[model samples]
Target: MCGSDLHYYRAENDGTPAESRCIGGHEPAGVVESLGPGVNGARLSVGQRVMVHHYSGCGTCMNCRSGWTQMCTSAPAKVYGKNAHGAHAQYMAVPAACVLPLPDELSFCAGAAIGCGTGTGWGALERLGEVGGLDLVVFGQGPVGLSTTMLATARGARVIAVDPSASRLEQASKFGAADTVNPDSVDPVEAIRELTAGAGAAAAVETSGATVAATAALDALANWGRLCAVGLGGTIAFDVRTFLSRQVTAMTSWSMSSVQQMACADFVARRNLPVDDLFSHHWSLDEAVPAYEEFDKQSAGKAAFVF
Candidate 1:
């Protein structure tokens, strides 16, 4: 499931931290039990292993017709754990269009990540254009950030990871971070510039939900560089003059499209990008409360509640 689930569970409707009695989880992988009448039987068999994309758009929306369902404007978008019931339970009902077939070699846990974490990174990179041979800096070493680092590294780009935790930085290093910057000790912008031989990074993926990290990433971007802000966090002040002078292109990315999710599953299957390492811990469904506590404290990496 995405980190937003943890946020919702820890913070109730008062806009502050409180216990949530609701069942919460979105990243789900299971066998298809049924399909609607309009869906082809051959396209999705009842017993096939599959994962669900958490976001669904109204089929008749202009955005959906244009293959941009994630940004559907005509109708209200349904996001699991937000607008509707999530997948933490044993059974979940999802639109057939949101279902994607999982590869035999991938586990349910890995497939779960593909739908959101990995797919979001893929969408961000796709929006950034060519990244091969470019120097990339990924802020925050969470699932989405680390996935971006791994994907960019796999594409033959040099990646520099920035985070506060040394443990997370170490994990990013294993995923091919050429350099790690802990902002607690050094100025991340200066460090990134030093690593890039004073040219700054060509692209940056900011996944840290902190304003400081976002500002640092933007400040360290090279001329004509693209910055994709994927994290949902506090606002940060930006220097408009610097942005215009440097000609930095900054954009925000949400969850991946259904097609991107499929491509991510295939990429993970082909490259065998260390998905197992992403899960630092696992718990039974009964231990969901403790799981949420641990996640709220940021004491673990990617976690899953096994059935």
Candidate 2:
């Protein structure tokens, strides 16, 4: 499960009755059990493996036609597992446009990762531009941050991962981070500067959603550096003159579009990257209560409920 799932679980969600509460599981990958009428069988079949794009919008919108249904402007958008029925169940129903073909080389769990967290990482890095042969720092060692670390390193970036948890930092190293930093033990900005020969990283991606960590990520960037913020929540102080003088570019990235999701899946499949390794726990539905209880602690990697 993802961090957002926990957020939905704990939230009162508009004071909706418990019986009408939304289900929680947006990153969904599974075989197609059936398809609705008017869906092209050539594009999707009864048993074809696929992943859901998760967000649906008004079909006539330009964004929807362009495959970015999440940015639909014509009407209210629906997010699976949030406002609508999600994939925490044995089966899920979604519009045909919301489905993307998954590479046969990857497992359903890996496809699920690509559906959200890993896809989020890919989107953030894309926003940061080229990172080859440059130093990049990723704040927060959660699933999304770890994915960014791995994907950036794969693209020839020397990644410096920052987190307060030693265990997460260790995981970052295993994921190909050249260096790791613990803000709890050291000034992260200073440490990052030292690691980069006092020049600071060329780019920074913040996934922790912590205001302090976001600020540190900004401070840890070199002049003319690019900063991509992926973590949600919390307002970060943005100094206009400071950033203007530094010539830093700061951009926020949401999750990937359907096209990007396919690209990310293809990248993972071609690299044969161990995307499954991101999951530390593979649980069954019967164990969901304890699964979330442990995941709520916020120290582990991704978790999945296997069918």
Best candidate, lDDT: 2
Candidate 2 lDDT tens digits, 58-164? 97888988778999999888999998999988999999989999999999999999999999999999888889999999999899999999999998899999998
Q: Give the TM-score of candidate 2.
A: 0.96
Best by TM-score: 2
The number of residue pairs in model 1 that clash at the backbone is 0
Q: What is the C-alpha lDDT of each candidate?
A: 0.84, 0.91
Candidate 2 ranges beyond 4 A from true positions: 12-16
RMSD of each: 2.3, 1.5
